[model samples]
Target: MTLKESSGVDNELNKGDRLDVPFPSICFFDLYTLKVFHVLKLAEGQYITTFALNKDNTNLLVSTADKQLIIYTDPALSLKVVNHMLKLGWEGDGLSPLIN
Candidate 1:
């Protein structure tokens, strides 16, 4: 669950931004605290293929092959975009065009 701790790892999360890493794993860090917050398990039987960041750098977009797209937004803000996506028929494929 935990990734190797190194300067490289820090580089991945330096700006509190989103990144699409191919590895089937994820690492969490606290921006304000600069601490290792979590080492989470990847979704069961689902390999993460790509990810993206909202323009404001407050939310994260994650994609998986299980026909799912997940959005992680700042808890303080309302999750309107995600709700809208759900409201519409926009499935996870909508994000494919934006991944590259």
Candidate 2:
């Protein structure tokens, strides 16, 4: 239920080692089963545009592909329906896009 300690992906990592870091793994603890769960995916991918974690860290909101917002309970699973209302040919910025 708590993160006691963590290590970077690099084997040569040390205290204050200045370098680009990778998330080793995302772990979740189950109170009922009294077990810790984690997943490791070895691959390269595009950068995360935006991410919002719940105040309790029990949920997550991820935004990608210009107009897709996904909600997740576990990092790999979609917890809820993401209703996306998008304009076919819209342009501009922010929540309300200016169409020309």
Candidate 3:
């Protein structure tokens, strides 16, 4: 989406920034349902120049109009996978960690 409209040279993407000024946002959506799942929180007012998703779909790389490069990772994907017999949802059973 285009950035919030401003007047003059500061009107375009990533020209000038202010703490109180609100800018455009980028959102990630589920391909199957076309529903937004996550949003990429970029630097304020900077338009995305390019972006790439890793082959594993765990990492995202972004380039902005201001020449800023950023990478984002999903923590849930980074978390270790384990099978616990004493499990009762996400609550720690206190013994699971010791075994894992």
Question: lDDT: which is higher, 2 or 3?
Answer: 3
Model 3 over residues 2-69: C-alpha lDDT tens digits?
34544343555565443332254568668997666766566665788898988877778888888888
In model 2, residue pairs whose N, Cα or C atoms come closer than 3 Å (at least 3 residues apart or on different chains), thus clashing, are none
lDDT of 1 by residue, 1-100 (tens): 3453643477556566655443566678799976766654566756677888888888788888787887776665655666566667566955422232
**Model 2 poorest 10 in a row by lDDT:** 77-86
What TM-score would each prediction reach against the true structure? 0.42, 0.29, 0.49
What shift in Å separates residue 80 of candidate 3 from its native position after superposition?
Answer: 2.7
Which residues of candidate 2, in runs, are more than 4 Å off? Answer: 1-47, 74-100
| Candidate 1: Cα lDDT at 57 | 82
Q: Which candidate number has the best lDDT?
A: 1
Expressed as tens digits, the lDDT of each residue in 1-100 for candidate 2 is 2232343354444455443334432344577974655443222342346778888776767665455565667533332212122343333344443356
In candidate 2 the C-alpha lDDT for residue 91 amounts to 30
